[model samples]
Target: MSLRTLSRNEVANHNTPEDCWCIIDHCAYDLTGFLDAHPGGCVVLAQSAGKDVTVDFFNLHRAEVLNKYRPQLIVGVLQGEKEEIIPTNLQDLSSVPYAEPLWLRARFCSPYYTQGHRKFQKAVRRFFAENVNPEAREKELDGTYISQKLLNKLAETNILAMRLGPGEHLYSRRLLGGVINGREFDYFHDLILTQEFSRSHTRGFQDGLMGGVCISLTAVKQWLRDDDLRERVMEEVLSGRKKMCLAISEAFAGSDVNGLRTIAQKTPDGQCYIVTGTKKWITNGMFSDYFVTACRTDKGISVLLIPRGHGVETKTIRTAYSTSAGTAYVEFSNVRVPMSHLLGEEDQGAKVIMSNFNHERFVMVCSTARWCIAVVEECLKWCNQRISFKKKLIEQPVLRQKLARMISLAESIQAWLESITLQMCKMDYEEQGKYLSGPIALLKAYSTTSATEVSSIATNIFGGRGLTETGMGRVIEMFNRTNKFDAILGGTEEILADLGVRQVMKVFPKSVL
Candidate 1:
């Protein structure tokens, strides 16, 4: 199809009863009565009116634009012609099937180390330029970003559809069942798993918009197996869909299995557990479908899949990272969950919770490494382009030294992660069950700390502009949020550090000296 291009002002003035327009892409669609439900404020639709926006829509808004509105609500023409631009030398070859493909793609694409690699580096650069812009890639959450076909399929499966609009609570609920639904799974997986697709689909904002509901939901489904309860929870997730979060944090305890205070007292009728306590700094706490919470039981600490409604109160908490899946201070007032909703067994909640963290930490480390790498690359690109003292910043000896240090740090962490992942891939469930705790803690602590340092150095390199939310500012924001997240989620840095020390001691008690 031929994609038609039009200017913002030109399109704004050409609005007709039969035409609808997308300001950022400058694509038009027919939306005569669609203005009423637009979550981004009608001005967005009115601004684009009847125009085409293929020029540079990303440059017009801040990176948070996608996070502020639902992209699906903004309709556009599918019949427009595709414009051909000069293709870069870099390309994504990972999707191509090969019988004896070289490990080069995986190596270069490794979030930690991509430098000195030709094809992979080039692909990475091209992917960033095309997808990472604020307007096109980063924006407030909007419903328009979701695929209708997938939504329809979900609806057909008895799943209620809640169109996620931007600025709502992120990561409030756990999504279940959709993984088996081919279309829905592929659509959602593309957003969470790939950087290239994420940028094009504005998934960061969606992640921020949905909070971590998708991942949390996936985890819950994996951990819980009751067909009826799972369906009920899935309905809740699909209902509000946009503003939900999972809470794993507790006051006075983190990453320490024995330190939890929230108690689940068993009742006579089918063993009900009354939970009461405060869970601090929970992601998506401000708004969440329900919490897959862990609490102490008579047998041991157990996991309770609790839905949010009555008896659960939350307050939004401010932090170093402003954009979030919606972090919150949560308090459970005698909340109760039936024995049927309990994940695994009593006191065995630790196992369930611990198991989730292993995979979660791995994903976080990969993403954190990717963020750091992206920051370094962005800083380098900026330094090369910006002239300082009659020479480029890249020409400065000190800058080169800093860049080298950052690269080295990233590479070291990357290597450790890769080695561990390889090890994990080979281990059986029994072996993994025993071997994962220490490594997971160590990796989380190491990667997060490294990300913090890399981001700080990258910001210093950028000078004052780095502090603002523009230019390479999004990288700074991502680093800040992700770094803090690394310390809090999965396991806190302090907790992990202590665990690492204890694990070593357990292995060699006599070598304490």
Candidate 2:
């Protein structure tokens, strides 16, 4: 509905409980209907009726609160008042300093993003902001699974296919609803997807919705030998008709692959294998119809494609984050699978697993970097408007220092990620597996460790609200709870750091003094 301009005297006329009105930052809001629902009670609105409440509103609430309620409450802007143009365009940089990547800011330039990339980014961001974010928030709060309607939206828009990363399936496929063709997709596009989608502010539900498919499907597409079976699985998942997950970590093993106890024994006929094992902390396991499993074999460890059926069990594992992720403890009891389900050669589970690490760790880097930025955004927004000691919080030098440090860390990690992504775009899969693993691991380690510090300072800025589940610090609260996930998941910082050094040492120059 179009709003009409209202004069101050006109606003003053609606001054009773039956027709209450208040001006917030020069915008008139008809709160007559909301008086009884006001948390502060009717007297507060009654007393402020017919008066400008801009100062009083800022003193009590964050700007986002106004954004959240404006659509419903706003009636008109005061005559002669110029409304602030808060941007809704996905490509527009937030006028707030350090809120977006430097390249997105006005007067900045970059060789990395093309017109097509920009279009793709805008389309995906708009989709998430309008559709995914709202549902993600609801599902995260209620511990409900992602709706099939949402999945259908993702499928029809080719988002599900895009998450699998660039592959044969993308050939001739329309991506971002035709914003870009699938063949044009690269690491930059993948990076854009991860970063933009993280804006949903519902981290756990983000994983619950598509994280499993993103990580697990790569292993299937790259290693699985049966072309027919692989195609079938891919079609099912890309259509959003079936769910899949990677079953790797067991209670006895996390980073240590050799310590896994899951076992697969080949039949005497050599046509099948009986798989028995348990996987713990499996993302998306609770709802997956297919499990890409890791198991110990006669020669060594092996990878198998196990369809869910009899003797397969999954129980929800509650986490610091929400249960919407479908985190699970899974058990397999002598489940039979065709030998054709083997991924890559037998006893080569390590190789199969390694195939996914570069992409996985890179994705972790993208997520943590964006998540840190998100926390910084929350701090900046809160500090700018929050009143304390008769002054805005940002007026304090100490708070500015915190923001400076957080922005530096967030921007630095993003620069490193962009450099690495550029290399990923140029390198072949084999080359990435060979030379990029250590660097990717190190990037993840640094980004997530940086995230730890960012989350801490941001929470300090938000104070009690940072700890609260709702209101001004909602994003901060979620980040604080879930930020540690990146630090430990994929690969731990200590392990990745050591691995990076070890990898470089393998090719270190002997003559270097």
Number of backbone collisions per candidate? 49, 0
Q: Any idea how many clashes model 2 has?
A: 0
Q: Which sections of candidate 2 miss by over 4 Å?
A: 1-20, 40-50, 62-64, 67-80, 85-93
Candidate no. 2 TM-score: 0.94
| Alpha-carbon TM-score of each model against the true structure | 0.63, 0.94
| Candidate 1 lDDT over residue span 1-513, tens digit each | 444454445456557544655544324443446666655466565555665543433323332343344244444333354423222222443322210012333533443222323333344335344433333333333312233343343344322222221111223322233222322222122212333322322323424434456446654655676778876775666654433455666778866657878777877775777888778777666656678787877867788887786788988676555433356788889887777877776678777876666665666665565566566666666666566687778899999998888887776775676677666656744465578778868887998888788878988887776776544465665565446666667778888878777776777757556
RMSD of each: 11.7, 2.3
Q: For model 1, what is the alpha-carbon lDDT of residue 131? A: 34
Pairs that collide, model 2: none
Give the Å shift of residue 385 in candidate 2.
Answer: 0.8
**Residues 116-180, model 2: lDDT tens digits:** 78788778888887779879989999888889999988988888888877767898787767888
Name model 1 segments beyond 4 Å from true.
1-211, 225-228, 231-245, 255-257, 480-482, 504-513
